[model samples]
Target: MKQFISALMDAHLPAPDGLQDGMAHTAGRRFDVYRNNVVHSLITALKVGFPTVTRLLGPENMNRVAGAFLRAHPPTDPRMMYYGAAFPAFLESHKQLDQMGYLADVARLELAIRQAYHAGDAPAMPSEHLAEIPPEALLQTKVHLAPAVQVIRSDWPVLDIWNDAQTAQSKAQDVLITRPAFDPIPQALPPGGATWILALMQGAKLGDALDAATTEAPQFDMGGPLTLLLLGGALVSLE
Candidate 1:
């Protein structure tokens, strides 16, 4: 049964051996039609999963890419929403798309948006919670980010490209993903923001993360990134 399904999945192969519908032989023509429909459905799902990539590459090119991607990496899980998890990396490695360096980052931003939208709900740390902590202790404290928080570090202007839905002129841009409500929002991160967030995500203390970020970018300001987290409700708990 597994072999039959595998053969069916690959359009190049003919109908699986001994395939019959209750003693009536399965028609090759019908099998081909079914295969085409299945491939089309999967391609459509990829289109829906990566809208930004589709827009950038155009429907025709995106469709072709989707077909190639599907052949290389099919959905392991039944859930369609998670099907294209590897697409961003795939785009980055694709020979044809190597010239369009920003395409992968754009795909990543879109993927992050989707992930944030589906992340599990968690209570956000209230503003008053900070008042309870002493200033010194707060700096040494480790913060718990909400499940919907995502950070993308890119060498291209990811946020600008995503916002404009087309390539834009800018320098390297890091992005922060947050879901204050049902919809996820992607905002460009300030200098050192990416470093700080990556450290925090790895369980670094606030002070430690700040130090690390400052080392990466001397002018990195902790205030801006901290304010973004607080305002976006991304800080779930502080320990």
Candidate 2:
């Protein structure tokens, strides 16, 4: 019975032959309507989930792209909230969007923001806690980051494109996504900021993370990243 119902939902089979009742006769049509509604709703949810991506692509283009995406990748999970996990990868492979090289990265950034918002919460370690750590141990220590912190790095100016689309007055910018409370917020980052934040989020010691950042971006500023992490609740605890 479950397999039959699944087939009906997927429009794989016709209604079981010859049912006398009018309601039973309409079952196929009803199922088709229901299926359409489900797809529509999921597509709408995807739009909401990746507003920045949608804004970058524009409405009509996004809708068409999303429709193609829906056909290529059907939802496997019951949870609709995380349905678009493959969207960035899908965008990357799409032939039409090849001209816009940064679209895939932008989609990734948008997806990361959604994940961060839904991530489990943990109280951040107080700034004083870092001070209490012995100087010698600081370099070897591993720190935990808040569940809401996510760092994304892309060669294209994805952060700048996102900011330009989102705000009227802001100049082109690179960004770090963080959720200090419940909502994810975008923070403009310095040249090597993403690499630095990625290390911190991965539990690297402060010094090691800084060194990684500097290696990648010689102009990376320690003060800026430190201040951003501390204020944004990215630092959870030091061990």
lDDT of 2 by residue, 1-239 (tens): 55544553455666544523465554656556656676677779789988988987998998888877876787899887788999999999999899988888888888888898899988878899978888888778777878887777677767767766444334334577778888888777887787777787776777898899899889888789778878888888777
After TM-score superposition, what is the CA distance of residue 211 in candidate 1 from its true location, in Å?
A: 0.3
Residues 5-97 of candidate 1 have per-residue lDDT tens digits of 777678777787766666597767767777788789899998998887898899999989999999899889999878888999999889999
C-alpha-based local distance difference test score of model 1: 0.87
Task: Candidate 1: list runs displaced more than 4 Å.
Answer: 19-26, 165-169
Deviation of model 2 at 112, angstroms: 0.7
